[model samples]
Target: MMAATDALAGVLTQMTGPWPVSAAARELAAAGVPVFPCVPGGKRPLTEHGFHDATTDPGQVEAWWRTHPDANLAVPTGATSGMVVVDVDVHAPTDGYEAFERAYRAGLVSRWAFLVSTPSGGMHAYYPATPDRAQRSWQAARPGVDFRGDGGYILLPPSMVSTNGATVGYRVRQINTGPSATLDSDRLRDFLDPRPTPPPTTSDDVQRSADVSRLATWVAARGEGERNRGLFWAACRLAENGVPAPDALDVLTAAASQSGLGEREITTTVRSAYRTTQPQARPSSTVQGSPRAADGWFARDATVRTSAPGRRLS
Candidate 1:
């Protein structure tokens, strides 16, 4: 099994060049491997496709193909043809695993999806076909979800996977059965369609920003020790307002700097808080009239003021 795995890894290294081959190969080598090589049509090449070499044993390559006959050499087509790949790092106890699972399940239901789980517990979700479609799908599924489509997050490929030595690339395996290369129009429609009117925003949503500010103030009052706590709440607040991660990171950084907390500490606290609670939800009113709350915490908080009608913090 190890030899076979190593052989598969080597083949991927030669073909893809060094983005992250081992991780991709691990997906192929998993117990119920979801990996598929896309052949343009349903036809297998007569030769080895020149992917083999002295270091890569021919028998291993043939064996991999034999087991994964659905793997294709053709360029991916249809709606998913231009799909962008987003890499998600699942930092174990963080929101990474849950986020990937939720996104994957959502995609399965939407038919506007493709996802791969890395050996490191991270995930890469791909939207089929068009870049615009992918971006739209991602935007419609932001905050709780992370998308790598255009100008979004960075996708770090496995170390040995590359298009050349410099550019990173992913392996494209064509599906021979189960589904056609054509895009699912319904799925595409959903991808292109605007999100349904959000349930009328509640007071909770509006007060959420204030609640975060209050939390920040509370942390600040506890001396510089709680600075990270303040930044965490701040990031959550900004993220709820549709801010991107980088922007949220910046907000957290600024908040931390002002409060005398380390960036790493702030980042860790925010990520930890994100894992534990839904940041968009309003904070408890118990903290409302506290010392932190008295310091103009709620006054300057935007998230609190924007909560949908009838959902104010109690």
Candidate 2:
């Protein structure tokens, strides 16, 4: 049976030039399979022609570079002074490419950067590196930064310049010089780490909390299943702000009325049933009365009112 990489090789082999390969394409290449740079011709066979002279221009190559001046071209082999190349495999959806470009531009302004788009929409960003070991040492200190000298990652043939043509070995056109003239490799490392930070609680969060509090109070006046349903609604509301389900349930039970139903019963019922049920049983058109206007003892009393203050329920 053909392996996954082999299957991808077949797909990449079929595309024409002026195309970008996604991250999946890179994997296939890394696995020793050749993928042609797709252009007008259907799948030209991969050869040394792919990485041929970096000084020559193929048809459509100049126009492609003009359109995407910020895009990087991969340096398949050899070391260039003052450039760092990072091999990145972009998966499908290519959602994060622009962000990566922004970050790269910020840190390496005035320098050339290259990104070879893989078959699956991922890219490799290449930058010029300082030739001195000391300067290069600082560049390598940053994780994910490559100096191209250490067998870091091979640029394969059939890779198109990001903007246009499919002919390989074409020199990458450098358009705008990056604004970041110096490489602060340490800061760059921190900037790229994927750790999450908690957002500061805002006035909107306070308002949401107040809304949930009022809801809990209204639910306390209701008996049994209705109270459980209210608790579930409040919990769901809190969840929109990243509150965990169990914690929201605890808060709901604590705020519920002590006399009408046991906290455990209400919480359990909410967890098992109310959480899964629709907010309202009947269609909005069929519902005759609001909870505030219903002909009930609780509805009549001011202290047991069910109406949302300063808001309408439609």
Candidate 3:
């Protein structure tokens, strides 16, 4: 299995030039890696079930490509592919290179097998998957970094994208020859987007505190179709327990952001929850001196996107 995985890794990292999408798909399948077709020039899956339709069967691979001959190539990440990816996004006003560099300097993301330059001038650092357990995918919107693990898929080299009226490919940037290392995704995420340290509970806080930390963590893990509902539910719980509106915002803003909810959406949902549950409580105009305000991490607006459970990143 290890040898097969190495060979599969080679199929991606060793490609020095463009290969026909179908050919690349076949090669990956022949290497024991399951593959699926994505919309040409885009990341959307062409099949009915997206990445869930990935298969190692040569017949299925051939059929899919025959139907969508110009389709892009993608593979399910994590244990299925024996690999994972650290996606460093580079966009206007947000660049993950610095955050990735910080992780590298801290000895957190050093063992990548290869690096793929994304069409959007971003990067994908491929690493070997940890054998003992599953590392689920996560998004740290503020840092502009995303983890492609158990519930995600990534387009491969030579897969082209239409960017700014010019076509660009997912090109291999560098391949490591030395020993490769696995990334501690959870630790890396915490470092990139550290949660605010809760302040010491005063008499006021004692009356309102109700396992805020655990509730925040749960909020952060909520996925699409449930993010708004989850945030509202958590906020209601906190409000019912006397957690102040300002305090609830401080705790949940970052968590909801991590789950891919935008700043406006988070604030609205949380405020609505508090208003619905605490009709008599006065609403504060601002959250002065809150832990989140002290850290200034939760104030920045970040666009977050998350994969559904057992689903690919969309």
- Please report, in order, the local distance difference test score of every candidate based on alpha carbons: 0.35, 0.36, 0.71
* Better-scoring candidate (TM-score), 1 or 3: 3
Task: Identify the superior model by TM-score, candidate 2 or candidate 3.
Answer: 3
lDDT of 3 by residue, 1-314 (tens): 24434666578654656588899889889888899888788776676555667899999999999999999998877887778889887534455776776787687887666667677667787788888778777666567677877757788877897877789888765555556777788888889988777888798775444478789899988877798999999999988887666657657865675565544467678888988997775443321111111222122221122222232212
- lDDT: worst 10-residue window of model 2: 281-290
TM-score for every candidate vs. truth?
A: 0.29, 0.26, 0.64
Ranking of candidates on TM-score, top first: 3, 1, 2
User: For residues 84-184, could you state the per-residue lDDT of candidate 2 as single tens digits?
Assistant: 44433221222233334445446432233323333323333443333343321111111222233221223433443332333433212212122212344
Question: What TM-score does structure 2 among the candidates reach?
Answer: 0.26
Per-prediction backbone clash count: 42, 32, 0
Cα lDDT tens digits, model 1, 177-276, are 1221223334433443334556777898778656655654554444444445556666666666664554344334433433434333555565555544
RMSD of 3: 11.3
**Two-way lDDT contest, 1 vs 2, winner:** 2
Q: Model 3: what TM-score?
A: 0.64
Name model 3 segments beyond 4 Å from true. 1-5, 197-314
Residue 195, model 1, lDDT = 46
Model 1: how far residue 144 lies from native, Å:
10
Off by over 4 Å in 2: 1-82, 92-99, 102-110, 113-115, 134-149, 156-184, 194-314
RMSD to the true structure for each prediction, in A, is 20.4, 26.1, 11.3
